[model samples]
Each structure stands twice: as C-alpha cells, then as structure tokens.
Target chain A: MRVSLFALILVSGITFTTAQEKDELPALDNPHNYIKLLAQDAALPALQGEEKFILRESWWSGRMEPGKAKLIQVQLFRRNAYQFWLAVPNRNGEPIINVYDSEGNLIPSESLNFEGTNIVSTMIQPEITGVYYIRVSLKTTIESPQDWAVIYAYR
Target chain B: MTRFFLFLAVSVLSSQWGLAQEAPVKIDLEDPNLVFVSDSVIPIPLEIFASLDKMGAQDWGRQIESRDIRLDANRSRTAMLFGLVVSEGFIGVQAQDKESVRRLGRDVLALARSLGVSAEVEEHANAIVNGAGRGEWEMVRQELDKTRQTVINKMKELRDDELVALVSLGGWLGGTEALASVLRDNYSAEGSDLLNQPELIKQLKLDFNGLPKRARRGDLFTQVSQTLEHLESLMRSDDTGAISEGKVIEISLATRNLVEAIYES
Candidate 1:
C-alpha cells in the first residue's frame, strides 16, 4: 500500500527490487484504484508518536437550521507539511482542499476531485504543534433545515 | 416526593443534552453542568483584537486602528474581558487543543460586540473586548436574536448564500410554520408573502441561477429533495403526527450534513 511515487524515484539507486508489490496496482487515476479508508486507522504509522483526538473520522454530527450556521470540528495533531482531504458523498463532484501555514492561514484551497466521489483535499501546515481543527459544517445561507456535512482527516 | 422526582428528571434531561453536544470541552451557557467550570479567558495583546478588526482583506501593510493602539498599550490588569471572537481567524487556532479551542470560542462569543459589523460595533467593541460579565449573557442572547431578526427582516438583502434557507426548508414543509413565524415578525407582509407563494419558489430558481456558476452544485438528492423537505415541514406543522425524537434525530443528522456542506461551508 506504501507505493509512494517519490520513494520509487529516490530508491532508483537500487538496480532491481522487482518493481515492488504496488506494480500490480494500477496508477491512481481512479477512485477505485485509490486507497480506501475502511476504519479509524492511524495515519502514516505514528512516526511522530501517539497523537489523540475525540472524533477523527466520519464520527460526528452538528445541529444546524436553514438559517443558522454551524461549524463541525475535526482536530489534527502536530504540525508538519501534511495533506488534508475532505469528502462529502452527497455533495459536489470534487473535494475542496485548502493548504495552510503553521499559523492556520490558507496557503491555497485546492481540490483533488477524485472521480465518482465528492472529496476535497489540501495540504496543511500547523502554526503550532498540537491539535488543529477543520470546520465541516454548513453556512447559514447554504444551510438546509436538513443539511449538515461529514468530514474525516488523516495526518 | 413529586417535586424531588421532577428535580431529578430535569437534571437528567439537561445532563443528556450536555452529552449530546459532543464537544470534549463544550461550555454551554445554557447548560447547568457547565456552571462548575470557571469562565475566564487567557488574555492576549489588544493588538490581536485590533488586527482582527482590520482583516477585510489580505493587505500587507494595512494601518491599525488608533483605539487598538491605546488598548494594546493600556495593559490594565484591573480590567478583564469576556471573549466573543470565533477561533477561526486567529493564527494557528485551528491547531490548538480542545481546551484551548473552546477557550478561544468562548472568548469570541464574549467579544461578540467587538466583532462590529457596523460603526456601532466600535462603541461596544471595547466593552465586548473587555469581556461580558454575567450581566451580559442575556444581552448576548438578545443580540444574537436581533441579528437573526435583522437578517430575516432584510430578506431583500438576501444574496445567493441566503438561498440556503429556502432549499433547506425544502418547499416550505420542513418547518415553514417556524420560518413563517420568524419571517412575518421580521419582514413586512409584502416581503414575506413570497416565502409561501409557489411563485417565489419559481423566482428562487431564477435567483439561484444568477449566482456564480461554480459556487455550488445542487445536492445529489436534488431530484426529490424539494418534495421531501416540504413534506417534512408539513409534518412538522402538525405536532400530533410528528415522528418520534429518535427518527427526527436521524433526519436532523442528515439535514445538518447536507445543508452545511451544500450551502454553509
């Protein structure tokens, strides 16, 4: 599953490692080929040690009215150059991703827009080294009396 | 004995609502359980508040307000403040811990007046910046209510984002009664009449089109969404036929995700 595009280039020094297991995998042009999140799993194997959170996956909900705005909280741990992807299965075709500096300011709001899915992804840099939050809720004007959002994050 | 039982019942219901808020460190002014936690903010530079005031754009060298300079330099420990700012704009706030995040949220709420959407926002800004005391919570609630009323009142001031309410209500069935009540009270009959008239729904479609092309997409369930919302609102109008709290909870969950994602966020 660790078929890193960059790693393949860096390890080019080795003459033949037999193309690695990921060779059997197609290039990630399709959502079907992309890695699927099946559980509340650790991101990147905890290289910086254990970081804790309350609700990390699609595990939370908020009460909002058609006229009131609500913010959903997803907390991230540690500050590093890491990517954050957001998806709403019921929303627009692509995910809107925003990259931020360590200070939580936007670097850019990017989109991965994986086909067949409505997910947004971005790279984030935390201003500090603790839990960072992402708001996954509705704007008052866009709010349906029945509308809310679902979000999950990986470090 | 009945009084004792009633007391226990009230306490139990309130406690459960606290559990439902889902925040690891939620401080609800409305919740009785939260009274145990002290309401104090970790003070920072008044310059921080000043900087936020000037944040309309990403100007590299925008001048700061002179009042902020005096407040920043005042450094009076005798005066403490209730915070009314949301933690979003502050640098690195998105990265803070739960306690820290809640503190920022609480402070922001306390400083709500300082958030100054108007020139009068400047007058109360320092009072809010200094923080709201127990005497101020009622005013805060009142202020929030007035803001809600003002928005509903100025429906012609409605923009594309304002369309959120129309769609969420889903053809006036979900909570049209509740919305109607709000609208009639805030907006004139001339203004609010369209809220119920089918012609307004048609006008809404036209208005929605005038928005930015890529601003947002109609929901996946857009096909039957309007019908469903109208049905829900109609059902809601009659309190007797309403669904149980559990199913209503499920619908509430769906609405929050959809409405927030499609319109709000």
Candidate 2:
C-alpha cells in the first residue's frame, strides 16, 4: 500500500508540474488573436481580389482604460496599401483609431465604423515612407481596463 | 506499462481540472472576434524591401557589397554581419541571383556558427540555397525571414540583448543601403517616400542609448548615431514625412559611406 501511494504521489507531482507549465504560457486567446481575426475579415470585403501579403508578426496588444489615450508608434513604408484593424470584445468601450505622421499632423484615412460589429478597421496609403503614430482611445466611462489590439498588413 | 497508463490518466485529469478552473474567467461567447486566426506582424526590413520592390526597384543585389563585410570575434559585429547577409538574401531573390543567394546562405551559416547559433540557422540556410536553385523566390523569401527571426530569437534566448539591437541595426542599414542605392539612380517621388522613416530613427536612437556602455562607446555605434541624426532631420522636414531629392541623395551617400565604414572597420 505504501509503494502504491508513493507512485501515486510522484505521478500527481509530475502531472501538476506539466499542467502548470502549460498554464504559464503567454495567453493565446487575448486581444491579439482578435486583431488577427479582424484582419482576415478585412481581407474579404475590403481587400477583395487584391493579392494579400499578410504580415504575420509585430501585432501589439495592451489594456486600455476608459477615457484614456494610448499611442503606438509604427513605421510604414511608401507606396503600399496598408490596412490597420482595431478591435475589442467589449461593447461598452467605443474605440477610435487615428494615424499621425512624424510631425504629429493627422494623415487622411478612411475608417470602417463598428456600428453593430466588434471590429473597426482603417486603410491608409502613405504617399511617403516614414514613421506614423497610431492613437487608440476608448470613448466610454467604464473603470475596467479593456483589452485592445492593433494589427496591420501591406500588399 | 501500468505506470505509463497511470501517468496518462493523471495528465488528462490534470488538464481537465485546469480547464475547469479557467472556465470562470468570463469570456464572451457571442463576441465574433473570438474566432481565432493565424497571422503575425511585419518586420521592418521586410516592410522596407516590400515597399522598394513595389516601386519597381530591380537588381538591388548589385548595390549590396556584402563580400566586404568580415566575420569577427565580437558577437555584436558578427550579429550585424548576419543582418546584412540576410538582407542580401532578399536582394538575391529580387535579382534572382542563385549564386549570390547560395553564397550568402553559406556565409550566414558561418556567422551563425561564430555566434553559437549554427544549429537553428543551418536548416534555413540550406533551404534558402535549395530554394534559390529552383528559382522558388517565395520559398527563398520565407526561409530568409525565418533565418532572421531564428537568429534574433536565439540571441534573445542567450540573453544577448545588445546583439539583438545590433542585428536589427545592421539589417536596417543593409536595407537602407539597398533602397538608397536604387533611389540614387532612379529618383522617383514614390521611391523617396520610402525614406521618410523618422519613427524608426527615434526608435533606433532609443535602442542605441539602451546598449551597454562598451557597445555605446564603440566607434561604429557612434558613427551610426550621427547618421541617424542626419536622417532624422530629413524625415522631420515635412509633416507628411516627405524629403527633397537632394536630401535623399544626402541620406543615400551617408548610408553608403556608413556601409563602407562597417566593411573597413
């Protein structure tokens, strides 16, 4: 009986450690995944028939509090049509995305509103190559942090 | 066999228990964004090359004198050379130069061996050479991208952050040199826009400052910083990040001179 108990304890310890390691992995089902989905959705209706060269890295995600602004700086290349997607699962937090050039002047861009959807996307064609800062903000007054993600692809 | 069965059972039960504990985290089932998809962000070198390629830049490999870059004991210099070689691989694909691609592949392997990362790089370089032989441009590009990422990830794994920064700086310079060379010969409005990268300059400034004092004091780093400052002024000249043709020439010359300096020193 003692030998059996010892085996059981060892098995449990090993299994627990294995499970703990899996749980400690970077959260896969977060806002970043959502941004990727939105990017796929944008590919269909928006970039239809265009050969899409999807950039599958550099997706940035963070928690944004209501009534606060978060600025993410990204370098964009010239002469490529880039589509940027911003989305969150929460409906109470209305998120707006905008792009600005290096001098902080707003660049003209077309944005798709999320009236009944959980995703917002924008497409910009920078005539010149340079760094552009994207400002994402929540318009609501919720105290809880809303997880958000921004992703872009150029073709 | 009995012990194996018991272990499997325990693992399965433990996983189920973990799911049970994680179930109460309140994930919204109705959210359409919950549908998972596979994609990743674009790296800066790839972005720059894509833009340059779109603007009808051709035979960029002729502009890259990667042969001049030498291997060194300093991991930082080695890392930088690796970046230039990978960028050269991209131009080889653009130029469809099989011999150059194969040579750069072997060179990348040599550099990786010096940095203690030959294991991860050997396969990618082999695939790159093999792909180039078949004129599989897309496959070669993918392998090159993987090679760059693998090297950077290995550097990070070894806790060599300084090398990581230097590798990127090297790749950036290589890409810039290629682009600037094309622009120098064929000055188009669209081609000039690709150099409007003030944000990258700012980030590089921060990266340069973050380097260890030993690396920061290095002559290469100091000279690169001076060039970055010059590029920054050019990028910020207009709100739209546009630069004059003359400014483009200046940057192109500065970048080419810097690349030469890298090879000489």
Could you say which candidate leads in lDDT? 2
lDDT by residue for model 2 (B93-174), tens: 7778888888888888998898899998898889998998898987888788778877886787788888888777777888
Stretches of model 1 off by over 4 angstroms after superposition: A1-155, B1-135, B150-242, B259-265
Clashing pairs in 2: A55-B40, A56-B40, A56-B41, A57-B40, A57-B41, A58-B41, A129-B193, A129-B196, A130-B196
Looking at candidate 1 chain B, the ten consecutive residues that score lowest on lDDT are B74-83
Q: Chain A alone, TM-score for each of the models?
A: 0.36, 0.69
For model 1, what is the alpha-carbon lDDT of residue A52? 22
Could you give the C-alpha RMSD of every candidate to the true structure, in order shown?
27.4, 14.1
Q: Which portions of model 2 show Cα errors greater than 4 Å?
A: A1-50, A87-96, A103-106, A112-119, A138-143, A146-148, B1-46, B49-57, B66-69, B234-246
Predicted structure with the largest TM-score when compared to the true one? 2
Question: How do all models score by TM-score?
Answer: 0.23, 0.70
Residue-level lDDT tens digits of model 1 in B136-205: 4323322322332232223324342433333223212222222232233333322222122232233334
